[model samples]
Target: HASFFHGGPNGSMGFKAIVNLLGIENYFGKTEYNNDADFDGTWGIWDEPFFKFFANKLSSFREPFFSAIFSVSSHHPFKIPEKYTGKFKKGPLPVLECIGYTDYALRQFFEKTKKTSWFKNTLFVITADHATVCYHPEYLNPWGEVAIPILFYAPGDSSIAGVKQAVVSQIDIMPSILSYLHYSKPYFAFGESVFDKNRKNFSVTFTGNYRWIENDYLLLFDGKKSSGLYQYKTDRLFNNNLVSKNPGQVASMEKTLKAYIQQYNNRLIQNRLTPFSDLNYKKSQTKNP
Candidate 1:
């Protein structure tokens, strides 16, 4: 099941295009969407309906299944259900209150699912699409804007549980899951499997400018040059730019960032994202010439 409570699969052109390209448009046994028009012109239905859809759909699947659920009550216009109006204390930002409501809904969903037969055998991965408004000054920096929680929960296996000190991102989810399932096939992905001990964990994000995070350092790059470098562990606010002071680190991270940009650009240009038989292309020649 690929269930969405907010935007349907066809809502975004980019999303539709990617799904079509990957040939995963019909991959799910069920694709559920919230039709707001049925609710007398209301948009953004509550999260409960989504949970119910997941429960009902999963019950019908006889074979192994992969599913995704997207929750949107935490998003704007930031409406807290009438039943939860005064439940949570008002925070600095309106979104925080909405977050409380959404969290409660998630807790309820889990409580109901834990009694199910599949709950003990499932691997539940929780993550947010993006972060909300930064209320604290410390989290107002470029790195902080992209900061969101990523958690993995395998009910029967306790070995993979607990905190992972390594940095990871949303892109790593697919590869990590494939690795966990012991998938033996060639595939193209921008991210390495986080569970692969031999692979270094890092995250790359771009919103107008580019930011690359590896270990303790974060390097920010504009189109032409490295503008800021900070030890995020020590400098949470990013007030200090160590680009001039740490030339070696800047150069190393810049080289990595450039390689990532080149690979991404090359892939998009060549339309080699999908692992189809006909579109045989060599590895990206993004290495320094």
Candidate 2:
């Protein structure tokens, strides 16, 4: 996929498999990742401290800069500061350990940025790249669900302030920022604007393995097996697989998910749903997840 935030290796096509299968008009993406990162061993990931750097330093100059940070430390190797090397007692705590550290890093960044003049005027919209691997009873299908987080912070007048209470998705965040700055935005983007609460509060999270949503209810579809059901409102963590339990509701959410899926799906077609990111945060990142 073409990433306006991070550059992709395939450059223009961004690895569009079955490329020729889809008409040229249908195949659209940037030539490569937006740009190359000096510290970026891999091409488009905005790994850890990188986000802090972007937020605290880069944004001051780039008027239209949209910071897309991925916490690398929170990823596989789970590399963290030396100070936290032996921190967790249980051999390794949950992956959330680094995520927790990332939050501290972010807060420190804000503190340093506050000393700068830009802190007051900038609009902050924080969110998670995706959910965690930890599947406690609370997170029900941690195996299948992607609890991507969304946040809103701004040095603006309204819109992104305290908790919105209303669920917001990363997709919706872009348009919200555009609207906040009163910039011209595209009409057909998949995400909704943050302020469009009156519109249906819909969010779709497509991971390589499964997809989930929290509309009026919590629903998950593993791509092949029809769908699964759970009441996300009541089941904060999807403890019970309500698909068999609530056949009626499961059928409805599956229909909604499928209906939305029909709009566009080339990305998911090839199973390239791996998060196009590196760094990640803990609970603080995605407001909801």
Best by TM-score: 1
lDDT string for model 2 (71-111, tens) is 44465555555556665332344566667666766776677
Question: Considering summed lDDT, which 10 consecutive residues are worst modelled in model 1?
Answer: 36-45
RMSD of each: 4.1, 11.5
lDDT of model 1 at position 266 = 77
| TM-scores for every predicted model | 0.86, 0.63
**TM-score (C-alpha) between model 1 and the true structure:** 0.86
Every candidate's lDDT: 0.73, 0.55
- Model 1 bad stretches (over 4 Å): 1-21, 25-43, 277-279, 282-289
Off by over 4 Å in 2: 1-56, 59-64, 83-94, 142-144, 156-159, 207-212, 222-225, 236-251, 265-289
- Compose the digit string of candidate 1's lDDT tens values, residues 144-229: 89899998888888888678788789999999888888999877788888788877767999898888999899988897899899
